[model samples]
Target: MAGGSFALPKPRPSGPPYFSRNQVANVLHQVAVLLELQGANVFRVRSYQNASRLLGSLSEDLGELVASGEIFNMKGIGKGLGSALTQAITEGRWPDDWIDLHTNTPPGLIEMLGIPGLGPKRIKLMADELGVDSVASLKEAALNNQIAPMKGFGAKSQQRMLDGIELLSRFRARRRLDIGLRYGEAFQRKIAAIDGVHRATLAGSARRRKDTIGDLDVVVAVDEADHETVANAILNLSGIADVKGAGDSKISLILDTTIFDESFTVGHIDPNVLDAIGGDDYEQLEAGGTIDAQVRLVPPHVEPFTLAYFTGSKEHNIAVRQRAIDRGLRLNEFGLIPETKAGDLKGMEAAVHSLGAADEAAIYAHLGLAYVPPELREDMGEVLAAETGSLPSLIETSHIKGSLHNHTTLSDGEASLELMADTARKMGWNWLGIADHSPTLKIANGASAEDLLEQGRTIQQYNAEWAEQGVDFRLFHGVESDILEGGKLDHPDDVLAELDYVVASVHAMTKWRGRDEHDNTEELLKVIDHPATTVLGHPTGRILQGREGYEVDLYAVLEHMAEHNEEGRLKAIELNASPYRLDLDWRLCKHAKGLGVPVAINPDAHSIRGLSDIAYGVMTARKGWIEPNDTLNALSGADLAKRLVR
Candidate 1:
């Protein structure tokens, strides 16, 4: 059972409310829709849509006003809509037509809208053209040539579509940090081999630790004379499916191969053959010629830089450019240039044109701003930090002392507690917490009251034995309790009190959509404030691509945690490190840290294979700018136990 902390506000008065004018309008609109769908007058349907739009724009909650029995006093609510509103508010059911329309819409079609290039219209067309209604079907159709013959889709477009689908399929839904790192290393090695190249680094999403990538971007510096050689060298690299375009300064490849895909012929190519191919020959080979390749050099100063800049998230780079513009400067991937240079900035966005000095710091100086690291270039708080020279020394992997949330055979986990403890010791951890699931989660073999007690005794025995043997590591008794409907924990207060530490979570209440049903965020806050609850586990309840977690206002939850901490709440937020569910998204870590909320970077490991995921968690923590002191696992075992007790 997943257990986590949450606090609930005092319950408001229950029962149905009188419909307000706005509520009446909304209900009337729904009635109109139902009426039209059932072959009612067209005018009535139009009225419903219009009224719905109007009601949605209203400032106050119509249901609240209706509950107060004050909605009848508002204008524009005739008897028809008023009746519908009252019924809906009291019973929580939509009118018939609205329900039917929702039912008729294919759920698969709705999911297709989220893919990058596919829109609603395109999805409908694909459904009509190739009978593809789901992502899986659409991908199969694209790969199998069902999409190429469609109007407006040529070979190139089909390839792009297929590439997009394949990219999405190959990587785990959220993309892993390691994929980006691996590609970065590959790019670095390729660029470093160029005779005149001084430096080559990857920036953008990869630097930000995004798990998947659309394309790889590499920035390189070379002597003006060697620019063409570097560009040619890059274009000549093996495994490039297509050269999107090549210019003197930069080269772009639509990667036809991946580190994981071995079926591609290049994977088996001899190193000697790879070395022997000239840039032109390589380009020809990449263009689908014979193995012998040739390449050419072009001027490198401008194009490579532009390509690098363009490859990043345009929104992120645009914000940076705007900052430079504000200071009478222009910034691009190459460097910062003066705004009055009397040249078009369009093509040269990535080229470092006019900065007086080399490196990012010098470019920032030119713009009268301090340098920002590539990793923190997302424009969140990095810009301000640069100006203040108060950038955080974000926690890195080495700062972590141990993992606080792990599983063993006592639950559904693959490894036993003793094995996990031994592994933790080998990893040089000063402490480890074994937090198996509580009993309510039968699928995971969650522990019963007796099981938990036995586990605790075993942990205590192991701790003593290890201490006697000078093993130096300590194991703590912990359990992950499930949060049930109505925001209640699986275990009672007495059972919870027996554990050395409790990590509360929501494993079952994922389907509760109505905020009124359970204030999930508030409930989590309450659990955090619970005397026995020490950590909130996987706060979002997301499983990466598998499922989006229960709806909770993350910012609100973080703020509440921060506020409670000031009141001496000992609750800590979890950064679960199950690669697929790196909950507590790194993007929000900095904000949590800013509030002085301690974050527990837990592996959430279920087995020995899962244990290695701690590295990913540590990377995520670093990305969030978490400091060692701000992380719960950074504490020594005794210290961690004491902290939990508090």
Candidate 2:
């Protein structure tokens, strides 16, 4: 849990595969745990533990460090440990002892180590005293009241283990959108390189950009003659660890996440999660995450139809199929043909060939509809909108000018203000906003009012320097002020009034969610009416796959925001773009658009890398029918600053 996710080296065609610094470091960390569990010498265990942390913190390339022999010169790593790290990186082979330790350890004990606050020592104690080997056995022990009497585990601790097991089960059921996309896109790329693959596109919920995905779907186009060759090649891809089934037309695979490159973000998938689900489940859920994938091979002629069928929200497909039926035509993955009698198969094939639908757009043209973007394929009136030629041009990533809710190291962010600003300039953005946490949220090292004011002066100084250089960029100062119980903003109006904006968010859900829905709605309404409140952050307080949003009357809240905007108060709802919390749920974004209440696609970023998360927000915006004109951040800095003025 100390280092980033441990990933197996992806297979390389020409040279030994490369391993990320974190991957190497995590391997050491796992070895340390194994050493301790095996009762190795205290100094020996400490060596691995110290080296793992050291390697994780190093920015240098692991292979280069090992090759130049600089790793041995480092403080904690001696020759023996350094040699193990070297072999893993240069030869793409984990140290023999590490593999042997894994083989000998009961996989159940490894999983038990994943429980929060349960370390290797605690796990060893459990196995020795109660003979608990797996999560199921641990759960059984806890349930049977056998764990409570243990010296270190009381009733409270036993209860927590049960709860942690439940949470782990839920995490394994599906993967977050970010994780799914990383694997799906990587798999599609590999498939496209196969000898005869004409085209490869991701389908299913992944194509629709859903917040969580159960399995990935990919549709490949190939000549009929190449189906067998292509399918065989796909099964042998490096990441395709397990084949569920294989055929000329379809292949089911379990993609190993360990083989994915470090470019894929794995920080969101906690290391504790990987540690707890060991063995086969551990392989299935690679430390970064693993997923089941299906590849469908179709002839080039039927590719369009197959893509559409697979890239479906079931309801959307059903509605379109019904339309075809009403027109005395049949729409299937193969093609659109006349709805003829069963005995007229030859005529049906002829009719399909004669239609000459070349692509998904052409297929839609045959149905008298405009092209519906895959994101809009949900059956939420998209069919009717397309038929009427009334779909709005959805927001694109380029439309964003700047975000008004981001953080710096002054609060909980990983980058400094200067670094964040420099990154934004390189990104070709006109402005960036710093809305570090207010003092009430101590967990984030929330900036105090004095700290906030000082930061404002720092921002002013940056603006002055930019102007002196004739640069067009600007920085707005603000706070992600907590919406306290009963709807009070964290800072007083006097403090809030000095800043450019305020993002009022409900962080302590226990207080707000404890009330009735009406009361919860009223609390948010109070924030909306606050003269200093500029935007509402993560409106639903929902984290995809982690938990459901708190119950509140979002309709009433959106209406209040709309009413305030109509009164010229200029309220905006933030579509928090952190992949984990694409809140303001796309389902409600359209309603906000209709209410004429501007939506702000704020990344709510905690680091400079996090700034790119806005792309995910833009996708969700497009899915919700949001356009450039409907968002606050789409405005240039000058326009946005003017609008933020009360």
Candidate 3:
């Protein structure tokens, strides 16, 4: 009452304005709380909290205000808060207060919050009470009999914590594409065995072509009446850890535990248990035992495949769907269906097809479209080409005539060259190339020029012996040579010129600091254009987590190779099937195919077990829409030799 002239603080902006500002301010306040909880400076913490509240009350987006230079007019927004908001919007970074708060928080704790039972309070309690700060420390303490003895932790709680840690570890180190497919296939098999489940297929990320998946999603189609029973049957499966959520038609559960647990436990569970838990859990739970569940179920007639079909990339599906629509027809997860006389088919494949379409081809023909290959389903203009009857013939496993790019004990490989050759022959390959590393890579026992010549003589003698025995397979001398800095091949040009084939690779240059500046793409293009270089080995020198390799512009390299046909424009890229580094990433394979560049789907096999990796490569190639004609290995040994020679 000093002057009795208090302005009542501008009456704090009425209605939604105050509410909206308060909400935003509340979020910012939460950030302050998090920072304070992490022990940030009290004064700085208050500033963020105050700013958050002030910004939330504003009617317009903070970014828009900042852009229009109207932020200064907003109450409580001074130069400091304004600058912070601008930084957050433009750089996708937190304010200085946030950065300071985060700096004090233990690393990986943010990710640890994702675990089912852990929360901020509990995490803080663990940190304060038991000196547990990291996932590794928590795991160590749990295993060492420290956590269960803590104030609120019980034996069951400790076990759950251990399970959570194990799950997190497995989830962190998951293998990509194949893991999803295998889990989906296994789940499909289980669902198929159930009596009332007329059809079952995997959907979601597995369908979308994501390399690694967090969960497996299977959608089953049954008779409308049988949905509840089928759902119950799935929930009752042996290895189910918990029924996360369920409805009359849909049920979500976590499957078996991690591989570490699987190997130790009886009746080892499927490795994809984490993926079975999904975002639909809460929805399914809320739906409960109502007809609303029926909304999620695919109809019996085409549900199984349709569920699988729809679970993939929506972008990919849209492309496929648009293709169907353009042809005066409709397509869905079920199958291609004719358009209704009334214009659209209500997304029902059976009803639309029953109106008198003969087959898949016939359905496409009716739409004035040519048959589209399943492998080339990734929209990428394939549908347009198919309509014009210009779709490329993608490579198939059968198109591969010979196995090349194998290693032996002469390097870091497990088997002898002869053993690898015998296995290649047994696999029905017409030829096999031994492309062990060169001398500089000490870890692999890479051969010197003299050693390579001796190895060549041994291979020649082995081929001579096999030829005398009338064996159909021929052995070609090759080397997986390291591409050194300055675009130097591992061996001198003369030695490389002597080999039947040269798989030029960036092994040591994987960690070269000047990757972008050194022009790895141009360097690679130069190698591919080299007269002696036959195949570009693992175009991306990646090793999973170990390194990402040079950011060589693959599209540019592919385009360059496409343009330089006279100097052997038909450069072959390796589909290195080392599970960790599925190099020449499948995404790039499509670009290569589009440019008419050749690919070599090599297992890059180091042993008999490694040879099986070809299946993985085949699937990867299929995903990229690579056809047999685009791969050099699809050629017969004589034809392949002829091409390599030139």
Q: Which candidate has the top score in TM-score?
A: 2
Predicted structure 2: lDDT: 0.80
The per-prediction CA RMSD against the true structure, in angstroms, equals: 12.4, 20.8, 14.0
Each prediction's Cα lDDT score? 0.63, 0.80, 0.63
Scanning candidate 2 in windows of ten residues, the lowest lDDT window is 268-277
lDDT of each residue in 1-646, candidate 1, tens digit only: 0111111112222434333333345445544533443445676676566556546434455666556755556555556555556566776554554556555655566546445455555676777778787778877887798887888776776677666554433322222354445545665676667777666666556656653343456666666777676777777776554555677755655443342223323221112123333323443343332111112232344334343364445545666678778877766655567767726755344243555553445555655567555556555566677777877777776667788788888887888887888888777788888889889988678899888988888888888888899877888888988877555777888877778888888776435444432366767766666777778888876654334466565666778778777877677889987655677875668778878888999988877767778887877777677778988877877777677765
Q: Which of the two, 2 or 3, has more lDDT?
A: 2
Off by over 4 Å in 3: 1-170, 204-210, 224-226, 257-297, 320-377, 465-470
- Candidate 2 per-residue lDDT over residues 93-157, each given as its tens digit: 77777888877788777777756457777788888899988899999999999999989679988
lDDT of 1 at 490: 78
At residue 580, candidate 1 shows an lDDT of: 59
Candidate 1 lowest-lDDT run of ten: 1-10
Model 3 C-alpha lDDT per residue in residues 388-435, reported as the tens digit of each score? 887766666677777568888887778898788878777778888889
Off by over 4 Å in 1: 1-198, 211-213, 222-243, 256-316, 340-353, 469-471, 492-494, 513-518
